[model samples]
Target: MSTFPGTAEFYRQFRPGLPGALPTLLDQIAPAASPRRLLDIGTGPGLVVEALLERFDDIVALDSDASMVAVAESALRTPLPHGSRLQLHHGRAEEFTPSAGWQPHLVTFCRVFHWLDQSAVLARLGEYVAPEGVVAVFSDRSLWTAGNPWQRAVRDVVQDFLGTQRRAGNRTFESPGPPHTQVLRDSPFSEVTETVIPVRRTWSADDVIGYLYSTSFAAPYLFGGRRANFEAAVKTVLAHFTTNGVLLENNAFTVLTAHRPSRHGKR
Candidate 1:
């Protein structure tokens, strides 16, 4: 089954953007000369694409889901930088091959790397990365996933509606094999490091409902005929936690970077 079937609309509307420190962090971890190229694997709704366009003149955004590609195309309708270009492809990361004469200085997988075979995907990337290029994997836990009081309350409501464990399109969700850092250490991209940035946001009950629908584990489509009931219950629970109709979400975003050693044996 598709990871996010029928959830593109909700994802585009509610998915969080990268943290403000991301640009600076990328510069430090994956510095490149002018006319840089980027490949964004699993580029849902073009959030990463939009964020990096100013720094990269050429970008290739790939996703296995057609609906996500369509929404990303729509979101990128605004004028890009003078010479910037974005090419969207509907394909899996393992199957993607960069066009002839195109070498990416940086390849990024945000929030979707857990869905891929880490070893295979990193191995395939060796063929596309330019010298000294880096591969960055990023993700931020959702409020419901954290064990805070309000977050736990929200998770309880979801569990009561669905179940204790998560589900994805008729399949029980399975934990990813190994930590990404460990996987990167074992892969060809052995030079691995990570950065964490704290982020906070205020969310309304309505915002929480939208965010819930955007996630694969709790998408509205997963509930089928009971979607409405699930949404109502979530809103009712969130309302209890809301102060002035807003709930505070304090979360941390992490970026793990991997690359081959440089001439001096440094990352």
Candidate 2:
């Protein structure tokens, strides 16, 4: 069975902190109009959902991975003064349908859409988003472009791994992102918009290794036959970069948002 950690472990390297920028990510997506309901598809651990709960009254989230979904569900279920405005479910995006009773005002897939079938995902997403609802595809790019030099070097090593093969979810802490993984262009979203936000996270060397292990493809490669080389590369990366005790990664990515006009369904 495939695990979602391919995505989870990567970001969790920066976890306990990555979600701090939620307010900014939310603003970039234009929650200005007030969403009645929100759905976070592939919501790894509800980082985005926790952000949504602060502004929107109702939220629904789904993740295909059991572990990822568990983390997200636990986050959403945390108690708040006004109570949680969030609902959590575990399932694949293809099997997830808009419940007959509710049409969400927004839909989102963060950092994991590339793993799904775009056309099918969108065709189904269209049904859930109220006519004027918006769909967002967000990624954090700062780690690829920003702070530390060693991080940049380590990134080069990891990408050499990915570019030579198909790697997804390179979630190194303080690590920048690899070049944009080409996503499906003309899918269900009627209109698309994107913005890049500058951000940073603190990380340790071990964090980077775990981050690599969380990749959709990198995990298998490292844990597979190339384990020695992969471990050696990580050692070389850390030895070259470690100064004092911390590594800073400069990365940036566009917060891409696509909208489906509200006139298409329940207003």
Top lDDT hit: 1
Q: How many residue pairs clash in each candidate?
A: 0, 24
**Which tens-of-lDDT digit does each residue in 61-153 have in candidate 2?**
888787777776665675532754667788888988766868776777777665676678888876666667677776663333434677667
Error of 1 at 149 (Å): 1.8
| Candidate lDDT (C-alpha), each | 0.83, 0.63
User: How would you encode candidate 1's per-residue C-alpha lDDT over 120-220 as one tens digit per residue?
Assistant: 89888887687788889989996556755787888888889789888765677788888999998887778888889998888877777888888877877
RMSD of 2: 5.7
Give candidate 2 regions above 4 Å deviation: 3-22, 25-35, 79-81, 141-152, 155-164, 167-188, 220-233, 261-267
Displacement of residue 71 (Cα, Å) in model 1 is 0.4
Model 1: number of clashes? 0
TM per candidate comes to 0.95, 0.73
What is the Cα-based lDDT of residue 246 in candidate 1? 79
Top candidate (TM-score): 1
